[model samples]
Target chain A: MSYLELSNVKKSFGTTIAVDDFNLSIAQGEFVSFLGPSGCGKTTTLRMVAGFELPTSGQISLQDKNLTYLPPNKRNVGMVFQSYALFPNMTVADNIGYGLKVTGKPKKETNARIKEMLGLIHMEEQHNKFPSQLSGGQQQRVALARALAIRPQVLLLDEPLSALDAKIRLELRLEIRRIQQQLGITTIYVTHDQEEALSLSDRIVVMSKGKMEQVGTPAQIYTSPETEFVANFVGQINLLPVKVVSPTQGKVKVGEQILQAGKFGHLNGNPIRLAVRPEELNHGFIEGANNLSGKVEAISYLGSIVRIRLDVEGNPISMDVFNERKLTIPSVGDDYQVTFPVEACWII
Target chain B: MKTKRINFWAFFWVVLAFLYFFLPMYGTLDFSLRMKKGVLSLLAYQKVLADPQFLASFRYSAIMGVITVIFSILLFVPTVYWIHLKMRQLRPLVEIITILPFIIPVIVYVFGLIRTFSGPPFQLTLTPFKTDILMVAGYIVLAMPYMFRAIDVGMQTIDVRTLTEAAQSLGANWAQILFNVIFPNLRTAILSGALISFALVIGELILGDFLARPALGPYMVEVGRDMAYQPAALAIMSYALTWICLGLITLFSRSNNNQRQILGR
Candidate 1:
């Protein structure tokens, strides 16, 4: 059964529609992420769940109670903003205790909760310090602690790690996941960072413009995207325009070369794109693997993985090669042969 | 060489400004001390301080200052917050209205206030208590510009919409958001406005004189009409009060080294 549900929710600002016919049902204790680029209606969806923005149409219910037009304060949904939004005037403990205090929680209980939250964020020593006294990462941690201190029914985090340094972002991201798992709180995280969304969420909802492109688990979203937008947005994938030669046989024409897409099954478009992850293509051909020849356009040594850009029959494709001590570095002008199993490519 | 020329010009202006500001104050201090003739003494200050009427008027003005500060803050802080958060399009209109007090001269403004509220359908100046009410209203209007701008500038310093949303999502009502979040964050700004309003109320004269209230401004003017040394002494005291207010603004507005470290610089 679903715990928090947004049913046909739509939001419009004046004439522009921000979120249209959005529907999602998140199960209890699930961590779901809304992943999209800027202005993709992901934050709008999260805000609706938190009761920060009232949906123009449709209902949002938590555990079967309709909260469609409820005021934010009446809804016990906790939200962490992108900017931390820590109360500068309050100490870390006081900030975390603010929600509890508002709900008339007893002093002893509120203090206990504050201590628990501070411990959760590993900032017990900085309890009395104000937000301005802490670093960006520490401030965001306090903000998260503040949100969770209320023991809200559901927690909403809106790009909370976007403002931190890259290293701090990674560390805090892991810390957030650990805390979420420990508490088993239902969480909805919004971020434009696809890697963050993929690693941190149980299910990722890829959004574009004002609609959901695809909703699936990390592996499913990366390997078998339902739409071209999802394939392009979630991860780096080379999309080659091809013509379907035989629908039942999963045969497609990639330039003058014919390739097999694993489950083409009833595809409609004449010149649909064949999608393949860069890492799926091997440097050399194996038996029963489809092979393509291209000239190396560019080789970028990116520490752990070397991304080699290649030109195949007027189309550009990239392949990621894992860096090993015995691996050969292909020059820019060298001809490269890449192969991928039939199952590795999909028609989007 | 370029810096030397710039420094010379800066020094020249500073000297000029110092003389222009302090010369009259120095003369008043000198005159206020020579009350006993030839021998410098604090006789003027002593007489001014001993007068019962002076004490009563000073107390009244101080009380009025406190009331005006409180009401101005209660009125303008929310007005500015609403303007910043929801009705931002009304800001230019609100800004014009707040500055109307400055545009209209104090005598003209007091006359308008008295004419509107004295004998009409709402005769607010009928009793002494009612007249004091009129005086406070006048003071609030007179101090509106400073109060609104202080809170507005403070509102600009922080992200008001995001903070309100954060508080609201955390189960805070509108009142809680204002008292616990907005007001505390705007402490320096509100303090600056309140002090300026208090200072303005303390030295206000036209409204008190016209409304027939026993405020310090009218009392000082009355003393100036009849007494020489005492008025000079009062002037010096008022000058010192204004300086103290300005000094407090400077001190509090230094970003509260311990409390206010803004994120992202």
Candidate 2:
């Protein structure tokens, strides 16, 4: 059995379903992130695993033990909230040692654990200071250390970096990744930010509404999204409605252009949708590749890369080009041909 | 010239407010001092302090204040915390119910309490002790608005739900979440509320007068009608007591604010 497994978990409040038939198994010492927009049941699923919320239906087990009926305190799962929910009355050391003290660990051992946590979070100087005396980043570190102090069976983080500045968010994101790797604790992270999920988790579960859209590794999820929602939600994808003319040859018709794709998993003459990422498009034509001409509708000058929105036979396409010293940016109203490799086009 | 004018106006309001509140206190202090003879004396204070009736009434009122504070904390802390957690939909209703004391007149409420609790169904007003219990109940109801607001605001300042979850995740049961987590964090807010509740109970006269209790409020009124100097002394003492409560509130909040500033929002 996996370290933590959730089977067909469903949650409903009145008529609104918060989570529906969500199933996932996390291996021991694995870091999995439940990634989606707000109200996508990602947080709800994490809470269920933490035993804060009971699954309205389905089973949850941690290390072959049934945890579905267990309360949060009994489940031995540590959670860090989006808001650093450190006890304001307790000093930094006390906040970190709270779990040990509450679990009736000896005072001496609790003190030693608190010292270790302080060293782990690199906040030994802040042990005597209260949570209210620490900065946002510092408080979150203390909060992180507090969660990790208990040495829980699973560490659940609910958007722990969402309540920070962009720079601090990035810095803490790397710090959390480092800590998770060092601890090798089975961690379930919930986040709305795709970049944070992509840059962190060993595997990402993309959710929408109340259903799991896709669950895969970061590379698999980004490269080959199973659902259109997952493809669009994970990253930028240029979706084109195409008519599949030949499923055997992987040929599809995009308006007036006939393009050969490598993923035409459909019947002949069926209207299917194809997704191509902006980064996959190469400027100028290449031999034996799908070359389509379009008029540049707009050009966005991002640092180090330029994004060009092109109108391809009335179909809008977004293309990204890295700024090469030898290459010039395509302007609006300029005619350009972009090459998309057959393998790069994903049929959704 | 502008700085001079600003300081002048500042000093003007300072003097005006000092006299506005201080004049009555000064007159009462002077009258209390003139009890023995031409010389200023502590004779009235000594008399009031020594009297058994004064001692009993003051002790009764102090006990009532403590009971009211305890009752307020026990009743509202969990009530407000629960409303914030599971029954958030009923928060507005709870808030409106708390403010009903402010809407109803105190005299009418006291009479209503007497009518409800004095009959055969309860007959709580028959015994002096029963009436004392009624007094504490009445005080809790009267102080509900302030108490609930204090606790609700405290709950708002922290992520109460998340904090509760964190505590639970750390192996804390419900009782630990209450005493160790929620209650400790809300210490200052609860203290502020208890102080307000204490001041209200000690200073309240309407309930004491009608409920036929031997509390400090009725004792002061009895002293006021019979004596010339002792009433002023009692008045000054009560004023000082209220001032002490207010001073404690300011001190607690200032310290809380100082720590919060270092933590930052």
Q: Residue pairs in steric clash, candidate 2? A: A132-B263
Worst 10 residues of 2 chain A by lDDT: A262-271
DockQ of each: 0.67, 0.55
Q: What's the TM for model 2?
A: 0.93
Give all TM-scores, in the order shown: 0.97, 0.93
Q: Write the per-residue lDDT of candidate 1 for residues B107-139, one digit (tens) a residue.
A: 888888888998879899899999888888899
Prediction RMSDs, each to the true structure: 1.6, 2.8
* TM-score (2 decimals) of chain A in model 2: 0.97
**Tens digit of lDDT per residue, candidate 2, span B133-234?**
899999999999999999999888877888899999999999989999888778778988999889889889999999888889989999999999999999
Q: Can you tell me the CAPRI class of model 2?
A: medium
Clashing pairs in 1: none
| Model 2 lDDT at residue A280 | 93
